[model samples]
Target: MSINSVKGAAIVTGAAQGIGKAIAIRLAKDGYDMALNDVPGKEDLLHTLADEIISQGRKSTIIIADVTNEKSVVEMIKRTVSELGILRVMVANAGIALTIGTEFLDTRLEDFEKVLKVNLMGVFLCYREAARQMVQQGTWGRASSVNGKRESHRDEHLIFFKEKKNNHYRAAAEMKKYGITVNAYAPGYIDTPMARQALSVNENLSNEEIRQQIIQRGSSSSGLAVNLGTPEDIANFVSYLASEESKFMTGQAVSVNGGVFFG
Candidate 1:
């Protein structure tokens, strides 16, 4: 197959780093062209990722847009279909952890709203725009959201996560007739830049300390995997979900959290 040859095209939000970056790269390797999305100021990272994907024999484009904005999301989908081919996958992975360590009473209203705005509303917009494009194109596609599940220890952001999961169910139902499947990937403590940032908040922890903290958290559960999961762990599952193998899966949030929260 030529470098431009592709199974389809996928748009992964928050593709600049962490799980989103992993998913984008994996999808590209899976033979799908990639449209990488991230907020402004992450152009360097996105550009570098796009180049890497192109180097791997797949077409790639960088789309800088804020998922929280409806117009931006629409434009992103439009540009993606315009640049790449039909949209086969939409990974709504852009999110923030502003209230990660804050208690419910200590969390400010602005912080809570910011979290919802990015994590909840962002996923909703991506799902809406992507579903619209898929329905119009009459293509079988997959849409998945990250951080859509709440962990027991992360109860402060319960509403945000719950809302994201709800969006998945609703989107899956509405898009089912159009041959589009919407799902959510609930990751436990994946080793990612975001996780490190969240863990290091107001703490004097080194990189190794953070890694050990994540390992301890995952080990607390009697899961099959006792170590912290890498971003590729979630991305590999996403690859399966985005493929024809998961045609029967929809309206569900699968847990990739190392058995931390079993379904």
Candidate 2:
């Protein structure tokens, strides 16, 4: 069935690039009018993505806002509801790694603070605002977050991973009465620009070497076939979790990391 036959609206932060971009596109294909957001100054990219969604016969709006800024995020949520109808799904996909590849002792305090602000605080604001709208609408809704698999050197990564897990339960508990499901998708070794950039920082390996290493490591780690994932893999999972078919599930962190680690 064509995804465009589905219904509702969704807001995806950091929708200009990487997994966020993929998710936004997938949702549009899934028949969700989209409010695509990215950090300020990414207007050109957002415009391009908006055009793509419009081409798909879904209403698309470019919402340039800083997820870390309270005022901006508030405006983003409000503008989305005002322009795109009631919010049906919230994809909190905007995040950053400020202290990657740095030693604990060498990591700057400012960098750590910035990471927390964007990765943790940003998700919190989006969830809060989206939940408010969902509760007011009195319609069932879904709030899904994009999370990562464990990366030892990435302190920011660990923080967001924990947030994704813990907040799933917390949000589910609080929002159950409102008929909104809170869940997360944990992706491992997806071939996105962010993943490539993170791997590329290892100066010891060439680009092809980095790619091979990622594939090998993910393959060896997971019980499934030794294949890494694409951004669409995660997007597919998000589409299901956002759909009415997943109504019975909540407070769950579904891992799409090729079975890398099992709980």
Candidate 3:
């Protein structure tokens, strides 16, 4: 599609790899020019993804910024509008999962803060900046986040995931007046590098063992599907949420976890 014929621009944070990369590609295929964002070191990956999007006949730009800093996020939004077009979709997918298997008592204060800073505070900044731009443009927009649901067992990192989910609801409620919708996708046991890293906390476990653990965890609840979901699964759902089809949905943390957790 030509630039004039494409859907409005979108900013997908954490677009260097895994779910973020998948979302960017899917959005490009769905015909939105993309602004891909990640931290400093992932320039190569972001550039490659941008090239792929451009090859698909859509405009793409790489914006490297730390989401935790307010100024950085502001610049990210500014650059997206300047480089791509009006900000119509913001996928606040950039996040970190640290100290995953560590006990709450053993977790350091700084470690806990780091998790919240990236997972919680980062999403807040992305949503806030994107909403500001959308409202200013006087146009309808979509902002979707990738989050995790609360589990029966406590993982320190899950706290921030829950908070991220809450942030989506609060942002959705507040941004509705401006014709902007905010929502989240809660994925369970997706086979992403991040998921592998979280499960690899035990060095003794083999890759197959870790795979089995993910499958088992995803199927723990009776009558649920047994296989782990792919990044494309979440991306497909996000495609709907980012489009006009999901106009009535907002403030919902929709579960894309193969029935592992009902929303």
Write down the TM-score of every candidate. Answer: 0.90, 0.86, 0.89
Per-residue lDDT value at 194 in model 1 = 82
Candidate 2 yields a Cα-based lDDT of 0.79
| Model 1, span 82-160: residue lDDT tens | 9988899999989888534556668788877887788888888898888888888987999888754544546444555
For candidate 3, the TM-score is 0.89
Please give the clash total of every predicted structure, in order: 0, 0, 0
Higher-ranked by lDDT: 1 or 3: 3
> Which candidate tops lDDT?
3
Candidate 1 lowest-lDDT run of ten: 218-227
TM-score of 2: 0.86
What does candidate 3's lDDT look like per residue over 157-262, in tens digits? 3455566666777898999888889888887767777777766646565556665775555424444544567899999999999997888889888778776657
Model 3, residue 127: distance off in Å is 0.5
lDDT, candidate 3, equals 0.83
- Specify the poorest-scoring 10-residue window by lDDT in model 3: 151-160
Estimate, for each residue in 1-263, the C-alpha lDDT of model 2 and write its tens digit: 56456477899998988889999999898889999999877899899999999999899988888888888988998999898888999999987764234557777789777877877788888998899988999999999886554544444534555765676689889998888999888776576666666555465555466557665544333444434578888898998988988888998777787665665
